[model samples]
Target: MGKGPGLYSDIGKKARDLLYKDYQADHKFTVTTYTSNGVAITSTGIKKGELLLADVSTELKNNNITTNVKVDTKSTVSCRTI
Candidate 1:
């Protein structure tokens, strides 16, 4: 038989589909607000390094996501793994 995509391709696709479906099923966002001097303000986890860094385009290029994205923060001028 000829070579098709590969063994990992099938597994990766299944995992992605599973995660997407699960996210749609029960995923939610938590909202919080701040007020000072009668002025209302809103903020949510502004920590820069906390964001997931997986680039979907790049991951799709190889049809796999083998690693997490690395990120940097200005507060401490440090690099953090995401």
Candidate 2:
């Protein structure tokens, strides 16, 4: 296949879509914010909840693509004031 104007763009879009789908199924929560830097997602329920922060960075050059994805999860803690 020959490189075209939208080659990298297409790849990027597909990657994003797939990531979103997997994140939703895994977390059962919607992404609050999405940007070139990263995404923030959270879930809350009666039993327990969690917050997920992911940093996504991509670089494309010379017909090569590099993607970095880092995820951080924080658990919710219940605290009582004494």
Candidate 3:
């Protein structure tokens, strides 16, 4: 038996659409949420292929906005111009 890629929540679909509209990037990014030990967390964006985190971080720092974290219970989109 094999598993399939899951569907996105309403918020996740909106976020993905907004990212695509704003960034005009070719890759499709998906957001996922999960709980570990009763802690809820969310992750947006995708990792660069063949790039180390350090390398990607440095590149983002140089060309993109510094990372920011926002806490919200409802769905919202936060973005920065690259």
Candidate 4:
């Protein structure tokens, strides 16, 4: 209250000036999880924007996973798509 504003008061300004200013109309998504045995699974992909309901039929089909990446093969597994 003493200061000009709280920590989050300028978050909207930051988003508009710093974040969204450089953001393109690109769609992206990612998911990560651990198995019962501790093995990690992750996936990332880009999705098409402004499409009909029929276009998003499949789970990964619409995602259009172009590439996959694996990290920490010996300890954990991580996947990335671009």
Candidate 5:
């Protein structure tokens, strides 16, 4: 009952290692979009595990809202508003 014998203390650390520890990871993902106002957005990612997003094309590209997002992958996200 007291600290649960330290079993949960290392859960976070173990989870981090299990998710981050990688050797020669391979993954590919791409996202492309064209705004109604002639704006274009493109993103590509290549890393470990299967790609969740790839070659995505969207029609309506105007995101001007505040929100919270979380991603658990080794990739790059570049956002440029026009």
Candidate 6:
């Protein structure tokens, strides 16, 4: 199976929701980490049909780490309209 895509940030969330309304353009993604219950939290937002990293690359790119990864996580229902 293929991995997923995401936009990552060290601090602060992407103020604007991520979504690509145009089919002609490549889809993009955004990722952020937040504090929750005294733990660090990471979230990813992706547009439809956008491909993130593949399963094979996840280990190599992330130093052999592959847990909590998203394979096909897309934006919430709100973004589906556009």
Task: List TM-scores for all candidates, in order.
Answer: 0.25, 0.20, 0.20, 0.33, 0.28, 0.22
lDDT string for model 3 (1-82, tens) is 8996776565488777877766743343445454443322444343466532211111123334544334332444343435
| 40-69 per-residue lDDT for model 4 (tens digits) | 456555645763111111122124444344
Tens digits of per-residue lDDT for model 6 on 2-81? Answer: 97655466233434223423334545545545443232334444444745532111111234432343343332122111
Candidate 5, run of 10 with poorest lDDT: 65-74
For candidate 2, list the clashing residue pairs, or say none. none
Q: Between which residue pairs do clashes occur in model 1?
A: none
List candidate 3 stretches off by more than 4 Å. Answer: 1-25, 46-82
* lDDT value, residue 66 of candidate 1: 33
- On the 0 to 100 scale, the lDDT of residue 75 in model 4 is 42
Predicted structure with the largest lDDT when compared to the true one: 5
lDDT of 5 by residue, 62-81 (tens): 46632222233444333333
- State each model's CA lDDT, in order: 0.35, 0.41, 0.42, 0.48, 0.50, 0.36
Better of 5 and 6 by TM-score: 5
- After superposition on all C-alphas, the RMSD of every candidate to the true structure, in Å, is 17.5, 20.0, 19.9, 14.9, 11.8, 21.9
Q: Which lDDT tens digits does candidate 1 get at residues 16-80? A: 88778555333223344433433222222332343522211111112332322222232322222
Candidate 5 colliding pairs? 27-47, 30-55
List pairs with backbone clashes in candidate 6. 3-54, 3-55, 4-52, 4-53, 5-52, 7-31
CA error at residue 12 for candidate 3, angstroms: 35
lDDT of 1 at 49: 48
* Ten residues in sequence with the least summed lDDT for candidate 4: 52-61
Candidate 4 versus truth, CA RMSD in Å, comes to 14.9
